[model samples]
Target: MHLFRGPGFVAGFSDRADGSLDFSDRTPEEAGRLWAGLPAVAGLGLPPPRFAHQVHSTTLLRVGADAPAGRQGQADALMTSVPAMPIGVFTADCLPVLVVAGEAVMAVHAGWKGTRQDITGRSIAALAEATGVSPARMQVFMGPCIGSCCLELGEEVVEEFRATDPGSLACFARGARWHLDLRGLNVIQCLERGVARAAIRHVNDCTKCLSDRYFSYRQMRGRHGTQFSFIARLPEEGAPSSGAA
Candidate 1:
């Protein structure tokens, strides 16, 4: 679904219906063949989308016009100001966040570890510094992810977040087990970095809860394929923003 559409950019999250966008367990040749058929990437008139090895770390890669098309490296986020060059992240239950500021855009993969490391905040800072755009002027769009209702975490994991970001304690709940709000914590990180609350939008669908529509790692028990979430700044002469697909 299209998460954000402006005069200069378009950002959206893909679903199972769009086909798995990551290689995962598939052979390289099979993956490449399947990627070629993905409807989301076909007919966009943009260059091949850029992705990263997503190690669940806070590493952020910057993509320029000259950057190569395939896997860029190990990173949880990708940012660029180059028009028509799409950047994205693959995720199953982890949050896929898209940020836009004028001509600059970022696609972030915020799994629990990345969130604990404040990847969202770091991306905002990096993009703002690179584009000279204030964090307040940036817009954030979050895609499907595991929600508190289904994201039961162990006490050690809960303590890890609590130790690093005490303020994140508010994002946890005590049920039969500790449930964490991955989306809410990222929103808090964005707000802490000066992004206006009104500027943040998200798809409320829980990946685990909506397994039929989205890929959910937890629901699939480590056998899930990932869907892609992407954004690109269109060239001046490119087509106008078309919301969703």
Candidate 2:
């Protein structure tokens, strides 16, 4: 249970360790459900997290009790200002981001497809619409994912990135295939779109490299589980005990 506590909320991604916090299961969606039901996460003051049926598109949904009711939504990103309503993103090699700003919290999923669609930038825009929190004032966490060291891309993906985010060209190294730096590309997009450099923090762990600590789709040839990353406003009434337990 890796964690990040911003000013008004607790946010983090579940690790791959075998225990109550282990969010991985047979499928990514199932893993999301399992982690949301964990006792420790419940103590953070929320019902089961609302997860997106990610399709690697640019769709971002604003969710809560008032907005949606089930785990059957289809979007790559979700934002909410409602307390006790947890929002999450499931990922294996893809990037999972949790953003906190004022009272608005968001969880985003971004693989090469979603990244090309600029989902992270849209998430910031969505939060800005709800509050005055700009990128500089927001606290953002980029969870563990496939890093530059292992994200080799084919020509099709390379051209897609080039067509969508021209700046993405800066995040690649040539080899047998293009060794792309997805994390760097997203951080670049955020900074270019207005996010302060210091406000963004990356977990910096490579899923493919850390085989014992995380599931990696590329490492496993597309057959692997996933990790859930979430963020929400901490319940002010009875906050759970938190620390290096």
Candidate 3:
């Protein structure tokens, strides 16, 4: 029931039924059904969405009805102006980004690598350029992620974030060993992209800290179920008026 949206579309990531994605094993169909049920869970009653390969880079793909199936391309973000196309991205600890302006929308997976590479900024720029959404009007929602508390990193990675954003130190603490604040850094990056501060909504839930209500790559150590978050442009006139829970 944790959902976030912008001016045009809605999206959310799911925790396991018990409110945790900390599972050792699960079938692909099991995962599929869980995602397919999102809209109903939200009260929209729509089916699941199409997803991209998510290479953790800054490549943003413009998706429409014609987009190919099974990994739209080697990209970390996907955008669409077409209503109901439902672009989506999957992740355990990576950031799930949903951006919207009127009817044009985008979904992105911004991992530390993607954040360092400026994926959020790049994808937002692409959305504006392709759909003519003024930055002043665009809104971005940064979903749950591995906060700095649990996202420990080596000096090399620490230096990468610091270099990309010197101000990000506020989010990182000198952990017992390394430093990290993947989410804070991403929020700084979002503000840098010209998105209005008032337009950005952040979900404070941390996947790693609130393990029972989220999926955490760090907590699971690579053997975890993945959850998908998605967004799709709704028709301006005839779209269903019923809101999802």
Candidate 4:
């Protein structure tokens, strides 16, 4: 469903009810057919959303109007300023973040590894630099993912985060196991990059907790389906094109 809609863009986060949108396991031809049948893509009359082969890295790819309809390359984030073109990412429990700045939009996939690399912050910075827009002017939307209540991590993982940003330690809680607040840490990263608190929105739903409504890789023992989250700059006649190419 659409989580945020503005005069020049729209962002959506899909659920299990919307059917599996993950095409990684399928052949290219099969994946293309499945993508074409999605109600979200067909109903909106949009081309197949541009995405990438997410390897949990901080790599970000830029999509132009002439970009292909499917997988663009190996990256964890896709950013675009082309109106009517959609960019997206797929996730089962990992976080999906959608960003909008003026006429530019981006879709990011942030797992623990990506978060450790501050992918969200880097994406915001890249977008700001590319579009000539301040990070404060960007709007961020976070989609469903494993929450702290169920995201148990190893001590090594905690140490990894500590190495990246010592202040991020606040996002972890000690108990029977180390519980990491993945979403909270990303929010902190965004705030550090100048994204306003009031400009951020999150679904707050835990994929593991609501397995019936969403997909959860951990809850499903590493075998789980995935959902798609996307954002697009609409082709409005009089919309202001303030962001960079």
Candidate 5:
């Protein structure tokens, strides 16, 4: 994956599929104690970042400086053309999709449900409508997630792929059950949706295996921290350099 420079935001994921935050690890009171200090966290030199409660459903919003706060919408993905308002997504084994268009960038949380529901397409369409950017002009970065080598699936998942994209079944391997490549499926979706191949970069990092720098819920047996993937359009004045993790 391309290195991301901070003063940006982060998304966390688990290893297996449920890569959500381990609230049990810290009580709401403790989290509140931490949340109380978020402004101080915001005080650090970085672009102001915001996120949403992803529901694995296809709901995308374009955030501006005046947008309301408090998870006002339900969406698996979010995009923004507004400068300095960074968008972020959370995942573990599921894919963390980041899209950039000139000065605008988008962060997507694409779990299997989001993927099957075409969350990427919805987000892109919204951005296109909002910014008038053609898909050819877009750059996509597919971050590390669960690889097909270990992302075994059942008939339900397979059926979902077939229902959405019948040809995607080729990415599935038959065994005692089936091993699938979710990243590959996402790549196919990107290409089919008009994102140029050369413009799309796949980090190909597997969270389950790359435990040193990333958190894998599957490898950790459902008890682990979540790593974040975030991007922000630089401000005209004194923007931080760009990198990736």
Candidate 6:
């Protein structure tokens, strides 16, 4: 597993070393035990992890302060300001985004579908409204996903981003085939949402290219295996305050 300490909270991305905790293969009960086995997640006294069916939709769910079971809701994004509430998203190649404000944390799963819908841009706006924080004050971390070298796509995909942003056409390239820069697109979204350039960080790994370290749905040839990326808000006082927690 890898950890991202974005200023005020803990964000983690699991890897192949985490075993087959993909919810697509094992039952939820079984997957839970596998996830809890990771050293980073073990014995931290974290709150129950929550996830959705991940239909690649743009639905964003916010967890309330008293929400312990994490709502069990169906959404591609989950956010919470409640301390210890670990919100997560499972992905192999698709982007996993974590946004953190002073007291709020958000986990986003941005696949092509959700990306086309501008989920990251909307998440910042939504979270800012919910937490009453400036978007510039939030730090964002984008986890490993399929990079452009490995993200070949049809011309239609290129046209899709162009039709949506037009300026986003810069992020797409024409080679033997078209390639979409998912990470770049998300970064642009954050910038558009008023997040500072320095506040955004990316793991910058290509999952399909580095399948040995991380799981890749494409590299695995449609395998159900996936790694989880999570973020949680820690308590105000005496909280560890940073680094791969």
Model 2, 1-245: lDDT tens digits are 68887656888777677333323223546655665567557566455566777889888887855654346478898888787667888788999988888877888898988888888888788678767787888878999989989999899888887787777788988888898888987898788768889989889999899967888888888755677788878754456633211
- What would the TM-scores of all predictions be? 0.90, 0.86, 0.83, 0.92, 0.77, 0.90
Model 6 global lDDT (CA atoms, 0 to 1): 0.81
User: What is the C-alpha lDDT profile of model 5 across 1-245, one tens digit per residue?
Assistant: 24543233332222323233333235445533433344433443344345666678888866776654324356667776665555666576779888876566788888777877778877776766677788788888888888887787889889878888788787799888888888887887777778888977777888787766567768778745765556666544465544411
In model 6, residue pairs whose N, Cα or C atoms come closer than 3 Å (at least 3 residues apart or on different chains), thus clashing, are: none
Locate the minimum summed-lDDT window of 10 residues in model 6. 236-245
Local accuracy of candidate 6 as per-residue lDDT tens digits, 146-187: 999988889887777778778877778889998889899899
Error of 6 at 116 (Å): 1.3
In model 3, the runs with Cα more than 4 Å from the true position are: 5-8, 18-35, 39-48, 162-171, 236-245
What residue pairs clash in candidate 2, if any at all? none
Model 5, runs deviating above 4 Å: 1-44, 68-72, 236-245
Instruction: Report, for every candidate in turn, its global Cα lDDT versus the true structure.
Output: 0.85, 0.77, 0.70, 0.87, 0.66, 0.81
The per-candidate count of clashes, in order, stands at 0, 0, 3, 1, 17, 0
Q: Residue by residue across 99-156, what tens digits does model 3's lDDT show?
A: 8877778888988789777788887877888888876788777777887677777888
Best by lDDT: 4
TM-score attained by model 1: 0.90
Quick one: best TM-score, which candidate? 4
The predicted structure with the larger lDDT, 2 or 3, is: 2
Model 1 lowest lDDT segment of ten: 236-245
How displaced is residue 225 in candidate 4, in Å?
Answer: 0.6
Q: List per-candidate RMSD values in Å.
A: 3.7, 4.6, 4.3, 2.8, 5.9, 3.5
What is candidate 2's CA lDDT for residue 54? 82
